[model samples]
Target: MGLARRIAGAVFLLLLLALGLAAWGRFRAPSAAERDALELLRVDSTPLPAKNAWHALWLLDYIIPAGEREAAYAQDLAQLRDRAVAVRAGTPVPPFRKWAENHYAALPKLTDDDRAAICRPVSQCLAQVRTHPEATRLALTRHADRLAAIAGLAGMDYLWNDMPPVTAAPGPDIGDVQALWLTAAASDFVEGRQQEGLAQACTSALTMRRLHVGGNDALGSMITARWAIEAGGLAMDMLAQMPDDAPVPAICAAAFAPPVDADVDFCEVSRAQWRGSFGSVENFPVVEHGAGGASWLLSRDQTRRLAAPAFVAACKADVRAAELADAHLDDAIQPRPTPDFIDRIGNVQGVDLAVAGVPNFVPYLRRNRDYAATLRMFGTALWLRTLKGDYRTLAARVAARPASVNPPGSRPIKAGPDGISLVMDLYAPVDGERVTTVPLPVPAS
Candidate 1:
């Protein structure tokens, strides 16, 4: 053969070999045992992507420098801890300002007085929330600026695509700063600072709502809304503890607006978001077996084609289960079965439902909405108590406001055996009758 003909023959042979390997890679499925082992991939509970950038920014400023004397702000924390211990011993406590000092001095942009002004209200607000008898010392008007600052920091929206990829495990866990505003709101309400308390509560609620946003990563975005729901639940629990006749402030009423839709649309939106995030990452995890004991490692995609379909189908089912549960809430007598079938997809050889990080989010997203729905019910119950002296009058008042008394996701509120506290559950009594009970602790006479 001539030189050009020989070269063409070699090229054709290489093309044939490439095609054969591609075909095998596509057709070969993992063994049953390997499928079982793949479930281990689901255990990767790394921190949410937001933790990365937030932590880096926080440490650069608030972290104490090496070899420096502890700042006065640091001393304030120590003093507060000591004071908290003393309060337990029945020691007389001073006014809010005495036990703490402003500590936002670490920020370079604010001047000394500006920092002091900022820190002072935060300190006092925290003290009020901590249940100081002298909470009346600070005017509610003083904390307006501080609450604004806290709201600003809580974040208006969470942008998932902007999140830098997780290069390594995240740094120290930051306490949820938004909780402080919540505590302040609860304290103000109890102290008769209704307007201010409602403002603080509203700020916290709106801040939580801000976490809902659009992005490529569906699980991460929903995680933000889910967090808002959990936080809002805490706020509702606080309101429930108030007197039945306590006038509901307008801001509190507004804050009580549902943080997210509690219908089929929510479930559909969450599943679609997860779909966008599916397989978007370069480093998909894997399991390896040989002479050595089996282990898991994060490698770029090598066998995703063999595993992804079952994983995605499982994810869809899990999301659909939540939707189905919501759709039937109006008539449900028992709690809907939370789907965990995805987690046990291949149990025969011990590998259950296995998936990469993106799909692993389905379980978390599913549970979060449930918790959110329960919080919404708690708020509704509080609203009911505010209008009537109790929640049991719903049947008589249904015509006054049709569909006004939907329980949390069709699950009724069950008062504790003592008939004082409320919980979100449906225990025995399978007759499908509408169950009703007061969720709040009965106020003292």
Candidate 2:
């Protein structure tokens, strides 16, 4: 009897403790600064839920990649996976039957032959890209036209037709957005179609920029920024491979140029918002760090205010890093600070950075994009001079700074086996070699 009474008493004590902890958690308040910071952090928004237009795309089987036929193939795949159950029961699977009927009805009524007919031109163009460098420009033009047509059929033409600030209706398959542009740029450049390559590459860069521009949605914006970085890098690569005599119009360079002021302005606005989010929460619910499972405990706001401001600084750091990278694009030897914002931003808490209007990925993406564009532009300039005269002339031209041919760290250009090279370092050394030779095309024997 006594033991039972003791057990009841212990249980009562435990219940009382739990109630006390819960009450404390509800009342714990953040400091004034913390409140302001919380308000600020809350400024960035989630992407608007645009109507999914992917179903219309799925209606065209011939143009879409197999991986992208999710809606069209889902029902069929599920039925096949569950074939044994249906066979054993010798009964029609009602759900699969309905799904299959609906899916098949919606799919385009094109036979295999019809599908092949639609794809023949595209296939031929791609084959030309693969086989004959002599026919590159024509092949690329045909291919781009064919792709544009297919994109129209798939309801994705807006990506090419529209500019930034337009939403992809039934959002684009974000995974596949850059694939075609990257391929086009590489193929065109290798085939000696410099103008075409530049056009395609620039189009890709513009597309990426358009995808996220003017939207405060962090994830969507960052995704666009990442693709922009990739597209910009590929654009530079194409430019670097162009023959010296290849014409470079002002438009080509302008394509890769980002509106730096707009980006900086956006960051400033976001940082201000992150600093402001903390003002509304009276008490922050502190999670109790203990062994008997976690519980919230309300207490006097005790969070150190340093992390909030530090996080905002980190966001600003990412923008500045991007700006620095852009400033060096026309030169070789990309200038990087010894301790970059990327390094500092990485050390910041992920939540703080994300909430503070710059995710950790932004700095890394911006830095790489900037460096790639700069290096490629430098290579292109040197290659052009090499075509005009001998290696000595190339060195003299670089020294003279006839164009924006300055090297990073003011590293002097040296004569290479073929033409000239910069014995320069890159950000985040690959294979630990700082000096690399930029090979120029050899003259016809």
Candidate 3:
């Protein structure tokens, strides 16, 4: 009986210890890493320059010696962090300047008619504009300088990013408008400014594709690229049907060419997800008091440690998805489903949640490729419209199928009703026929 009682006492003490640890974890102070991450991530509260290159070859320049890029960055970051802390604690900080501010400030404010005109689809509105050109014309006339300024953005390479919004974070800073660059180009097209509109459209596509903002784990870049491609689609639809064979001007030539595909990467996105995994200390209380939010059962570092393996697994999966992206569009790559064992409802330790949250980039990648191929096929129509050739040459090219524009026997460039339209992965068949019948423009006789 004595031996049994001793064994029972030992078991009870162990149970108490476990409970004590759990309670402490559920209410522990934010770790140094968590504090540092918050300071760095919530950047708008401080005075660092734009996170990326600006219109005139700009990045936040740190003043340390060569071969010490990371060191310089760290030093600058430390100063910035200090300033942020001081400002938040009611201390005076030095004034800061950013070149992007001037450029944005110069943008023409949108008027009611201009906003409404931007909402109109350029292709459908052409006939409407020709007959009743008052509204668009008014917008065009009223905002001529604005139009010019917006068009000039095409010449300047820039990436518009507000960063993966911690807006849901406590006392978050206001974010910039997300789709202004895209909408600006669309508005230009809607207002009947063909040349400038094309230039803007091309620039928007190239900007997103060329210099994709790397840090944020959001698919905003890929999604925005598709939006730009769709805008190009709108352009193609408009140009193909136009009765007049408008010449692709010397300046607008490059804009008509199909844009290159963006390099597929989700590693940075994974890091962002990982970083945000640690719920902010400020917001933790709200989570703790409100519901069964992890108070958390593990410290921030412990949580990160537990979650790192899963993040790596998810990132590796993304890399594989990127490989499959290069394969044929219909190539089947199964997505990694969330592990079944993890409990989401009261998951204090988010071990597999990050892995599950990693987006399936496979579908989006194929769409981007199809859009690129379709744009290339549409490029042929643009060529025929502007670069009319001898009948023999034109007929030969047409007869050869879009092989003149694409490789022989590509699926998307297949023949359509009005000589050659398009068909892609996204295009669905109607009445048992899979085709998009676009009215390819005839060069004026």
Identify the candidate with maximal TM-score.
3
lDDT of 3 by residue, 26-53 (tens): 4444445444443444344211344332
- Residue pairs with backbone overlap in model 3: 217-269
Residue 190 miss distance in model 3 (angstroms):
11
Worst lDDT window (10 residues) for model 2? Answer: 160-169
lDDT of 1 by residue, 45-103 (tens): 23354422232223333424323323333354355556555654457766534111143
Candidate 1, residue 10: lDDT: 95
What TM-score goes with each of the models?
A: 0.49, 0.45, 0.55
- Report the Cα lDDT for candidate 1: 0.41
Worst 10 residues of 3 by lDDT: 169-178
The models' CA-based lDDT, in order, is 0.41, 0.42, 0.44
Error of 1 at 396 (Å): 8.5
Q: Candidate 2 — which residues are off by over 4 angstroms?
A: 1-36, 44-146, 149-172, 185-194, 209-242, 258-307, 317-424, 428-445
Candidate 3 TM-score to native = 0.55
